[model samples]
Target: MRTAFFVDGYNLFYGLLAGTDYKWLDLPGLLAHVAHVQDPASHLVSVDYFTSGVKPELATRGIQSKEAQDTYVRALKAKGVQVHYGRHQLDPAKAPRFIDKQTRPSRQDKVDIWKLEEKETDVHIAVSMYRLAARQASLAEDGRIDQIVLVSADTDMTPALRAIREDFPAMQVGVILPHRAGIERPPPGSLKDYSHWMRRFITEDELLAHQFPARVPTRKKPAIKPEYW
Candidate 1:
C-alpha cells in the first residue's frame, strides 16, 4: 500500500517533543516506521509537515530558538520531508484570568496578554490532504495513494478526515496522535470517529531510535543539531 503522511508540527512539538531529548527527530524515518508497523505492505510515498516559524521575541531563548527551528526544518527538508510554512500572528488580546485549577475563569477577571497563534496550518493541512486525495483519484491505481495518515492530536482535522471518508471510500484514513507514552491525554474522539484506524501514542523508544545524526547535509551548508537542543 502506498501511504502519505500529514504532520502538524506545532501539535507534535507541544504534545510529544517539548522538554524531551528527541528534538533532533528524523521525521521521514519515524513516520515510515510507524506506517510499516501499521501495515507491513505500506510504502511511504510522501511526508508533508505543516508549521509556523518560531517567533523570536516570544520564544524563551529568543533568536537561538528561531535558529534551532530553522536548522531542524532544513534537516527535515534534506531528508525528503516537504515542509509547508504557516505564519505566526502575535496580537494584543484580553482573556479571563486563570485563578486556580478548581476555579472557573470569570469574564469579570480578565487580563491583557499577547496572543500568539499559528495561522493557516490546519486549513493548509486539510486542503493539502484533500487535494492529494482528489489527485490520486484521477491517477492510475498503482500511482494512487492507498492511505493517508494524520499525525496530530488536534480535533480541527476531523472535518477533513470525515470528508475524505465520505468522498473517497477507497482511500484509507489513519490518525496518529503525537502523545508521548508516559503522558496521560485522552484521545480526541472526533478524529478517531473519522479515521479508519488510530495510533494513540508514540513511545520514547521509537523517538530515541529515530533521531537524526549530529549533522545532516543539505544543498548548501549542513544542518547541525542545535547546541541547546
Candidate 2:
C-alpha cells in the first residue's frame, strides 16, 4: 500500500497555540511520526504541508519565529513534504475593539491584515490527491493514493473526501486529529466504510517530544512613537 499525507499548517499551528504548552513543533518531524504508523506493506510517496507565509507584524508578536518558520518550510521540502503556499484571507473584525470617549465609547472592527496570507489548502489537496493517483497510473490508478490521510478537523475537505471514493473507487480516506492528543472523532462524511477510514492517534506526549524549542528570548525595545504626537 502507498499513502500520501496532507496537512493544513495554519489550522494545525493555531491548534497547538491555543491548547498546547509547546509553542512550535518540528513540522516534518511530526509527519515522520505518521509514517512510522505504517508497516512494510505501505510506502510514503508524498507529504504535503499546505500553509501561508507569516506576515511581518505578527511575526514580532511571538506567535512563532518567522526565520524558523521559513526553515521549517524548507526542511519539509528537504524531507520530501511538498510545500504549498497561499495568502491568508483576513476578515474585518476578527473580534472586537473599543474606544474611550467623554460620554460614550466608540467601537470599531477592522480586518486583521497583519496575519493575512495565502489560503489555498483545499485546492492544493485536490490537485495533489489527483496528481498522486495520476503518477505511475498503472501502479494503482484510482485517481488517488492508496491511502489519503489528512490531519485536520475541517468539514471543508468533505468534497475531496466524497469525490475520491465515488469517482476513483479504490482510494481510501483517513482523518487524524492532530489536537486533543488522540481522543476526538472525525467529522461525519459520505465516504464509504471500507474506502474511507478515520482515526485519532496523535497524543500530547508525542506532540511534546516533536515540538520545537522556545525561540531565542529577546527584550522589548523602547518605543519611538510619541504619545499623542
Candidate 3:
C-alpha cells in the first residue's frame, strides 16, 4: 500500500510529546515504522506536518522556545517532510472561571483572559487530505495513494475522514491517536467510525527509538537539539 501521513503537530505535541525528552523526533522514520508495524506492505510516500509558528511572547522559554521550534522544523524539512505553517491568534476573551472539581462553571462568573488559538490548521489538514485523495483518484493504480493515515486525536478531523470514506470509498483511511501508552485516553469513536483502522496509543520505546541526532546538518546552519529539551 502506498500510504501518506498527515500529522497535526499541535495535537501530537500536547497529546504525546509535552514535557518529554523526545521532542527532537524523526517524524518520517516514526511514521514509517508505525505503518510497517500495522502492515508490512505499507509504503510511506509522503508526510505532511501541519503546525503554527510559536509565539515568542507567550512561550515558556520566550525566544528560545521559538528558536527551538524553528530548528526542529528545519530538521523535519531536511528529512523531506512537507511542513505547512498556520498562525497563532492571541485575543482578549472571557470564559467561565474554574473554581473546583465539585463546582460547576457558571457563565455569570467569568474571567477575562488571553485566548491563544492556532488558526487554519484543522481546515488545512482537512482540505489537504481531501485534495490528495481526489487527485489520487485520477492517477494510475500504481501512482495512487492506497491509504491516508491521520496522526491526530482531535475529533475535529472526524468530518474529513467521514467525507473521504463517502467520496473515495477505495481510499483507505487510518487514524493514529497521539496518546502515549502509559496515558489512559479513550479513542474518539467518531474518528474510528470513519477510519478503516485506528491505532490508539504510541509506546514510549517507539518515540525513544525514532529521535533525531543532536545535530542535523541543513543547507546553511546545523539544526541543533535544544539544551533544555
Residues 1-229, model 2: lDDT tens digits: 6677888777677654444554455555666566556444555666788888776556653434555466556545544667888776755434333444544432455334333545676778767766665564466354335777777666666677666666666666666655555445554453324235564456677777776433322233221211111
Q: Write one digit per residue (lDDT tens) for candidate 1, span 110-140.
A: 9999998889999999999999998986788
**Worst 10 contiguous positions by lDDT, candidate 2:** 220-229
lDDT of each: 0.94, 0.59, 0.95
Residues 1-229, model 3: lDDT tens digits: 9999999999999999998999999999999999999999999999999999999999999999999999999999989999999999999999999999999999999999999999999999999999999998679898999999999999999899999999999998999999899888878999999999989998999999999999998999989999999
Task: Please give the clash total of every predicted structure, in order.
Answer: 0, 8, 0
lDDT computed for candidate 2: 0.59
CA shift of 142, model 2, Å: 13
lDDT of model 1 at position 142: 75
